[model samples]
Target: MKIGILTSGGDCPGLNAIIRGVCKPAIQHYGMEVWGIQSGFRGLVDDNVVPLEEKVLSGLLNSAGTVLGTSRDMPFKRRFSASSEDKPSMMMKTIKKHGFDCIVCIGGNGTQDTAYQLSKLGVNVVTIPKTIDNDVEGTDVCYGFDSAVSIATDAIDRLHSTASAHQRVMVIEVMGHNAGWIALYSGMAGGGDIILIPELGYNIHNVGSKIIERLKQGKPYSIVVVAEGIKTMENKKAAQFIAEEIEYETGFETRETVLGYIQRGGIPTAYDRNLATRMGGFAAQLIEGKQYGQMVSLNGSTIMPVPLEKIAGKARLVNEDNDLIIQGKRMGICFG
Candidate 1:
């Protein structure tokens, strides 16, 4: 079998590890030919590809970012073009020209939706979810989540010393547009005084009260961890808005730190590398079994295939009643 693989959407730490995981087994064990598609679906539309030899997959397990490259390009999405060009049709042509039996798409939510569309067009498709947000549906956890949470947690831990020395309220923001897994996990792990997630709405007054309460309890410093997508003023960023509001309400010095793309960079954590390897190997196994139109998903300790239709266009979001939240609240950690 000839399989074509591509990475899509935002780049993260575990991408190269998963690519290596897929290519190594498919080449050495299954005796299948593997091809690397460059720059996500754009590569398919543009017919940009290269043969993946065993040597090409070496030393990638600890690498950050993808060697195959990636993009936010969605061929299935409608584009207002002057020329009469159909991207999806062009992609199908490339698939047929290459004689690919199955295309293994490694990406997050948008990539899953596109893979499903390709399957509808009769192209064999299998996917592995890769996102630091941990929002891709039909999977208990995605590969890059562990790496990102580790980075964010480290950042929060470093801020603790400075916050204490200056006796200031430090507001740190982590990535999570539609979900709050990063902020919630890192905040609790890093011992944040207040945690704010997009899943639960927070009041400025409540945030202020939490800071004031911490001060009254002989805690001169406070750490506020917030998700980037948390509700704020129309044109302001979450951390900046919250920091300004906290300073205004309590008359305390407050500062903001946005841990933007830093959370998505660097070598993947050991947990993430293992998860990516498991997911990638499982995806190849599914292809070997001719289980097309499925995505490799992590369900507890097991890696299994989930139908593409079940997860396309869906996202796994943090809930208000998450166990960590309940435990944090019980421990008198404010959630605002």
Candidate 2:
């Protein structure tokens, strides 16, 4: 049978590994012809593709980013629209013209949404969750999360020395885009004094007071880990704003470091590499069963198939009552 594959939305560390996993088993064992869809959904609409072979999957298990390439999921706008409703129909035509029995879509929430849309349009899609946010529901963890957390935590740890030596409030911004897993894990591991998440909006006044309290307690310096997804109660959050706020409120010098793109460009963490490999292997198993509209997910320690429909509707969030929140409280980390 012929199959099409694509990775969509924000790039992740385990993407290449996933491609290797899927193509290895599908091509070697299932004897299926796999076509790599270039540049994600745009490729689907534009009909850009190439055949994928076992050789193409070689040595990709340890690589970061996707070999199939990727694109954002914004159905409202195609890269270049020829006409209204023409794009979606054209996307459908690509699937038919290529004579693919099914498609494997590896990506995050936005990508899943795109897959669902395609499914509704009569193209069979089997999704694989891929996001560092770890916010995609139905999966205990998604690919690339470990690498991101590791990168953020390492940055936070390294900043401690400089922040302490200079007696400054170091506001470290890490990627989340919509979730707090990166900031939460880094703040906890790196011993950040303040951690901000999008789910729980903060009152900057309280955060300001915490910094002042730290000063009074003889801790002249503070480390603040902020997720890019979060918003302060006043609804103002640009990295520069956080730096200025420290100076304005506590009268202490502050520095800002936005860890944008840095967390995304490193080697895959050991955990991510293993997870990606396994997820890819598991993806092959599902395709073997001829399951459609399903996604491979890691639930606790087991690999499971969940309907792509449910996984697309809601995002998994950090449970407020979870152990991490408790640990943060014991460390006296402000959630503001």
Candidate 3:
């Protein structure tokens, strides 16, 4: 059988490793041909593809990003929902015309949703979940989460020394378009004095009081971890909230550092390397077993192939009652 693969959404670590996993099993075991589409769906739309072989998949098990390259140029573009029904049909036609017997897509929610639609159009598809945000549905852990949280945590850890020397309020901002997993986990791991997430909106009184208490406790320096998407009690964006909070509250010099795209690049963590490899090989196994339209997801410690529908329109947000949030609050970490 012939197979095709593509990566979509924002660039992430471990994407190339997943491709290696898929092509490894397909070629070594099933004698299948795999081709990679360049620049995501647009690659197919524009008929740009490169043949993938065992040799081509070599030495990328721990590499980051997609060798096939990627882009956000979806058939639906930013509409997300409006382009699904019709654009997916066109995508399937493009796949079939390219002579692919099956397709494996490795990406986050948007990519999986498109994979499901294309499968319904009679294209056999397998998906591997990959998101640094860890917000995709049905997966306890996604491939890039480990590396992202590691980078974020380490960034905060490094900031501690500088904050101490400068004796300033260092507000380190990490990526999280809507969720706070990165910020929360990094906060705990990096010994943040304040942890702010989108999940918990706090009043100025709450944030200011915590900073005041920390100052009273004689800690000259404070490390505050903030998710980029966090919101205020009044429901404004966290970046905006930070600006307002900085203007309204006073005591120490405030500085904000956005980790930005640095968190998405770099070598994959050992955990992500292994997870992507397992998920990739397992994805090829599923395709051979005739499991179409499924996404390989890690359920705690086990990898389970879930029907794409199970993840369609599904979002796994950080638990509102998670111990991290509750414990952070109790320990006097401000979430504003």
Could you tell me which residue pairs clash in candidate 2? none
* Residue-wise C-alpha lDDT for candidate 1, range 63-170, written one tens digit per residue: 888999999998888653964778998898899999999999999999999999999999999999999999999999988999999999999999999999999999
lDDT of 3 at 163: 83
Higher-scoring candidate on lDDT, 1 or 2: 1
Badly placed stretches (over 4 Å) of model 3 are 76-89, 232-244
Clashing pairs in 3: none
Residue 197 local lDDT, model 2 = 85
Q: What is the C-alpha RMSD of each candidate to the true structure, in Å?
A: 0.9, 2.0, 3.0
Which candidate tops TM-score?
A: 1
Q: Model 1: how far is 273 from its true place, Å?
A: 1.0
Kindly list the per-residue Cα lDDT of model 3 for residues 1-336, writing each as its tens digit: 888899988877768888887898889998998899998887877678889878988889877678999887767544345455455556666787878988888888888887787777778889888889988898889889889999999989898889889877788888997888888888988999877777776566676677777778998777888888865558754545564585378556777788889999988899888898789889988988988888898987888888888888788888768988789778777776
- Candidate 2 RMSD to the correct structure: 2.0
Models sorted by lDDT, best on top: 1, 2, 3
**All candidates: TM-score:** 0.99, 0.94, 0.92
Which 10 residues in a row give candidate 1 its minimum summed lDDT?
76-85
